[model samples]
Target: MKQLRVKVTNAVGLHARPAAVFVGEAGRFASQIRVRNATRNTPWVDAKSILSVLTLGVEPQHEIEIMADGPDDTRAAEALQQLIASDFAGKI
Candidate 1:
């Protein structure tokens, strides 16, 4: 498994559109991606599922842990790291 620690930079956190974007990005990879609000003490959720991601209740300034397992895990982890670090390409 590959993992990354990223801060949520989106103004609204991982709600709605941002969550949708995240789920979309996660779907591109063959690996299984999961995310948890590290700053909050929440259970990890499947990054590829919008409902699961939204349940994370991630907010701006929240630190998150992302884990990717299976083939392409490294690439998947990096992609999500970059996405969050980029503020979801200003989509936030």
Candidate 2:
């Protein structure tokens, strides 16, 4: 398993479009990915599910942790960390 923690800097946080972008990115990987709102101390949720991620209640400046376990776990974790760190960048 691989894991990373990153702070969300996007204005709207992970909601609506951003959440969709996040779930889309997560769906690209073959590994099983999960995410949790570290700042909120929330339970981990399926990263590939829009509703699961939206329910995280992530907000601007909130920290989130991502984990993945599989053949591509490392890449999966890093990619997600970068997605949030870069505020979704070209993805959104």
- What are the lDDT scores of the predictions, listed in order? 0.92, 0.94
lDDT string for model 2 (36-55, tens) is 99999999999999999999
**Residues 1-92, model 1: lDDT tens digits:** 99999998778898999999999999999998999999998999899999999988999999999999999999999999999999998655
Off by over 4 Å in 2: none
Model 2's lDDT to the true fold? 0.94
Clash numbers, per candidate: 0, 0
Per-model TM values vs. the true structure: 0.95, 0.97
Model 1 accuracy (lDDT, Cα) = 0.92
Best by TM-score: 2
- Which pairs, if any, clash in model 1? none
Error of 1 at 33 (Å): 0.9
lDDT, residue 60, candidate 2: 98
